[model samples]
Target chain A: MKKEHVKIANREALIGVGLVIFNFVWWFAFAYGLGSKDPQEYTYVFGLPAWFFYSCVVGFIIMAVLVTIVVKKFFVAIPFDEEVEE
Target chain B: MNWESLIPLILFIIIIFCVGIWSGGYLKKSTSFAQDYFLGGRSLGGFVLAMTMTATYGSASSFIGGPGTAYNQGLGWVLLAMSQVATGYFVLMILGKKFAVVTRRYNALTMVDFLKQRYQSKWVVILSAVSIIIFLFSAMAAQWIGGARLIESLIGIEYTTALFIFAVSVLIYVTVGGFRAVALTDAIQGSVMFVGTLILLIAVIIAGGGIPNIIADLTAENPNLITPFGADGSLTPTYVSSFWILVGVGVVALPQIAIRAMSYKSSQSMHRAIIIGTIVVGVIMLNMHLIGVFARPILPGIEVGDRVMPLIALEVMPNWLAGIVLAAPMAAIMSTVDSLLLLVSSTIVKDVYLNYVKPTASDQRVKRLSITITAILGVIVFIMALNPPDLIIWLNLFAFGGLEAAFIWPIVLGLYWSKGNKYGALGSMVAGVGLYILSDSFFPQPFGLHSVVMPIVVSFFVYIAASLATQKKTV
Candidate 1:
């Protein structure tokens, strides 16, 4: 039982790190990859530059949704009262 | 000063004081005064837990200094600041269940308590306490200055008088109510920040004649303002990416935020907090920084970046509505100040005084000391804030980097890696902090990365080497 609990926590932490990396890759790519273009050549989405529109605005919604799903599906509710034996 | 705007702020302060006093009543009837006062008896629920973490993490830096910097740097800064969206998620998720179980098993009140029990080293406790006090002092001073600056601009009061008022208000409630007061006030403050950010964003966009017009003005002035490289192209891709470590992953080591991980009522609250916190932080950070970038077209050439948030709000909205919206930054500053004040006080009283000074001290004595220490720390920070930096964000970020450097590896590796011993923890902190200061002062942005990255990287190896070298000694 104890080993299983530790495994669950480790798995969740990995998922958390995975989400962070995924968010960073998305943010960096859109921010720099597309944003590296000249200003005169930029496209607008809702008044924000295309890069920002994708990186920050769209990225935020994606992260919020992804995080909600991850928490609901991947995270297991663990008891806080009992002291885990070392 | 417009009296209409000041009324809402005054009303907000009054409500916070009432909450503080109400929570103080609980302090006296608690079975475990230390636990109740320091950790809020670990009874935090979902919404309160999420809000408190959000409020505490979203300090004057995020509300005032962040917008100020974003206003200067333009949209690039906003992209960099968005790294914070995952802050609450990382803290709650990585440290969520295991941290709560272990700390509860150890009956640890502060982060230092956990370090002390886990490492069983006097140096570890002393170092943790010292680093928290040193780093959090600057962090607290940043909040105090932000508070005073907001009050000074809003009410048109003298800086000294504003500082005095801000300091007194925070000390009164924090000393009276403890963590419960801080957490409760944080819930209110966090909500204020969310609504304020949304309202101000829409107002700024409308005032700037919408997004297309604003982007046009920005391009006319400097095309780089709308780019990812900042107004002057100083925000390099390398530097921006490193911030993912500074504000993103490394935040788990912040004592003020980490303590919240152990104080929640159950796993359900942690899970709930993770979702709620991620969404709130995303919305608030994205909107607040966007407001900073958007305000550029409306209010151009503001010399002080911190003044942008208040100046733009007053310019775009009616005086009454401006006052109410401005309370959001005020709430952010106060919530952060109260939490830091409590954290430093706990480090001094619970970690240092109780552990080393007098282990046999009575509950009443500890309680009195905690209150007294909290007030004293507030006064000291007020003194530090009097000579404010032109941009308080650097000071706040400097504190963040230093604390993360010192605590990140020890806290994370200690939990996961069984081979992590006292030598490793101690070695990591010393190397991390030492290298961080050296890099920050002499060789900032070495290799085009933030100074924090090197120290954190170097210390991770140092932790493993030191731990492996000393394995036989422990056995």
Candidate 2:
């Protein structure tokens, strides 16, 4: 049981680090990869330029979907303890 | 003056006051005033928790200043602002179970309470409180100015009278209802923000002759307006990317937002909030900023970006509807002000005065002190806000950077890493805050990144190095 507890703890930490890295990569790509451009040179999409479309609209949609999936999948719900009688 | 517009705004304020008064009844009957006043007895459900987090985090900057900046910077600023979509998710997810469990075990009332317990160091508590009071004064003042500005623009009143009205309204409700009042009203205000942003965004797009014509006008005027690069080409890759740190994951360190993570009643509520809060924040942020960018074509050449939200709403919609729409920004401002006011008051009364000065004070004394301190802090912030800045977003962001730098590692590492000790937390805060202020003053955007990035990086290293160096032998 004690070893299992440590394994869960290690898994939680691993997941935490994984999410952090994912977030970093997400922003890094948006900011550095697609972001390093002159808007005058880029193609526009739906009144928004490609960079704007991909980064803000697409990025927001992806984040919303990703967050929902991750929460439902990885976050195990721990029931709250019943209120202690004073 | 648009009297029609003012009527809906007046009605909105009246509704807010009613909510405040309604919550005050709860304040009266709560068994422990401290828990009820500060954390709302940790009874916030999923939706309320989601809205309170959204409302508190979405300040005047997100509503007024953000749209204003987007108007100027075009789509790039909108892209930058989207970084905040993950804010509520990050806070609730990263700190969700652990924060709630530990803070409950410790019976912690404030963020400072958690820190003091985690570090087991007096210096950590004092530093945390001082950092909160100092930085949040600017943050609170920024919100006060925002509320005052929106009122001034709406009713055709002078700034001081508007400030007075905004200050008094917030003080009355927050002092009367405390955290429960703020949390409940935040639910109402968050909904306002969501609906209002949608209405105004649709209206702005229609007013701009639809998306196609708006795009044509924008391209004809300045091609960069539709692109990721800002109008001035100043929203550089480095600057925009680094901003994610200031507003995104770093949000977990913000005491106002972080406290919400601990206040929810159940893990199911946390899970629900994680979804709802992210969706609400994403929609509101995207629509509001898009309105700002889209408004540029409809209401061309507005000088003050802060006035973009009000000016565009009035320009696009009818006076009555515009009044209702403008209420969203007002709601945003009031919700932010009330929360910040309560947070600083809790810092002083619960963290400092109660901990150091009178640890044994009776519940009655503590309640009186908390209310009085909240009122006084409101007045002090009012005085500070009289001379309003040109753009309140900068003030708000400055405060955000300072707080995030100081508290991020201490809070995050302290939670995850058992080896983290008082020496590390103290060193982290001192180094983080001191370096942040210095960089912001002198070497802003060091290496082309936001001023906050450097301090956060430096503090992280300092925290780890100091912790390892000072680790005492465990018997």
Kindly state the fnat score of candidate 2.
0.50
Candidate 2 backbone collisions, by pair: none
The residue-level lDDT of candidate 2 at B325 comes to 91
DockQ of 1: 0.81
Off by over 4 Å in 1: A83-86, B60-64, B386-397
Candidate with maximal TM-score: 1
* lDDT by residue for model 2 (B367-448), tens: 8898889988888888878875544445455688889998999998988788888888889889998899889988988999
- Residue A81 displacement in candidate 1 (angstroms): 1.9
Q: Could you tell me which 10 consecutive residues in candidate 2 chain B have the lowest summed lDDT?
A: B388-397
Residue B302 C-alpha lDDT in model 1: 97
Q: Compared with the true structure, what per-residue lDDT tens digits does model 1 show for residues A13-68? A: 99989999899999988988889989989988987899999999999899999999
Q: List chain B TM-scores, each candidate.
A: 0.97, 0.97
Question: If you assessed candidate 1 against the hidden native complex, which CAPRI class would it receive?
Answer: high
What are the C-alpha RMSDs, in order, of all predicted structures? 2.0, 2.9
**How accurate locally is residue B194 in candidate 1, as Cα lDDT from 0 to 100?**
96
